[model samples]
Target: MVKWDEDIYNTPAYPVTDAARYLGIPVVTLRSWLKSRPSADNNDQPALEPLIQRPDPNLPQLSFTNLVEAHVLRIIRATHGVKLDKVRKALDYMSQQFDTAHPLVMKRFQTDGVDLFVDQMDRLVNVSRSGQLAMRETLKHLLTRVEWDEEGIATRFFPLIESVPESEKVIFLDPAIRFGKPVIAGTGIPTASIVSLIDAGDEIEDVADEFDCTPAQVRAAIQFEAQNRAA
Candidate 1:
């Protein structure tokens, strides 16, 4: 059996659709990011390199690291309205300077790399001074959802239960746990399982009792499932 620490996080585990659903982005957007394609106006130019690479070129799957990288990209693109092309240029520069294929997942990115990325973006695009500040703040906020290990690698991802100021870390995805499915933070209980019980007509209090979790946790799981379904 493969040891839990032996490339478990990097193993191709999530389907492209699942990754997009988890990250709350459209499937087409995720596919565009993973597959190289010609520029819209200049089809003659060489295709841009994919932002995240699939473990197998033929398989439409993503590892945990890919999910994290895409999540960061989603935040950068959605929050500040920066185009993927500009984000790609900034990421390419960072990848060369940081000497890592996955620069966004590096813990150093939370500290040292954000400024470099912001400065690079300023040079690559016409972002205002205040917009640069907003970009930094947004990156800082995005980093809060990621938990890093001692080796400075991302270990756990807390997906938003709701896209609101009061969103809590009630649900998380750890590749080492349950094949990277979303689970309640302190328990191994899958959020989908909890939501399933709720869908089967179990009351929130009863489902919490059944799972040995809080009613609030069950509610959060339900809300997460609802959001994913709507997405």
Candidate 2:
């Protein structure tokens, strides 16, 4: 069974809406992945397996580890056209092998799990040689956004904003600051706070000036909120 941690410091508590924004994934999509909502007509249908087990089975929001799984899955699905069921199977394989509920956050994923994951996907998707290399690199990029303890367990996530790739990020979700809300990398200003000013009809440059951030950052905040809400 997956471990559950309710202590705020030990697990991410980003609401479903905000977690979706930081991950650049739709809220409904994330919800569907985290929990199986049975259709009104299909009581006998087999339950769909979730990709990653959340730290809390009761809460609707995602934890930091859950966000990491979403991040890597997004890249694989988008770039390689892999299906979610296949990804779920690969995760199951890793979980059983690694003896951990959250394999993506562990050091094992980057080492042996990456090859095993790619191999499973290749069987289902027939990824090319270059595609396999790309998959490995994607895994590496996912690792970069996480902060690990000396024991090598992932504890904190510096969420790369949807508008920014991990390689070119200017925003992050630090749990200690602003309650783990997405913010300008060094500044504690919430992206949503800046975006609110723009939504209220303030110009981007003016919002930037008000927040002591660049016009581009204002734009990023605006884009993050816009896309997230739309999801």
Best by TM-score: 1
TM-score of each: 0.92, 0.75
Question: Whole-model lDDT, candidate 1?
Answer: 0.86
- Give the candidate number with the greatest lDDT: 1
Query: Candidate 1 residues 95-172, lDDT tens each?
Result: 999987888988999998999999999998978999989999989887889988888888889887674343468888
Off by over 4 Å in 2: 1-12, 36-49, 123-126, 155-166, 200-206
Model 2 whole-model lDDT (C-alpha atoms): 0.73
List model 2 lDDT by residue over 1-231, tens digit each: 333344443474868777777777776777777775453347798775567567667776677667767777777776677777677778778788888767777766767778888887788678899989998888776767766665566655665556565576667665567777778866789988997888799998888889898987887777777766776
lDDT of 1 at 71: 88
Which window of ten consecutive residues has the lowest lDDT sum in model 2? 1-10
Error of 2 at 35 (Å): 3.3
Worst-scoring 10-residue span by lDDT in model 1: 1-10
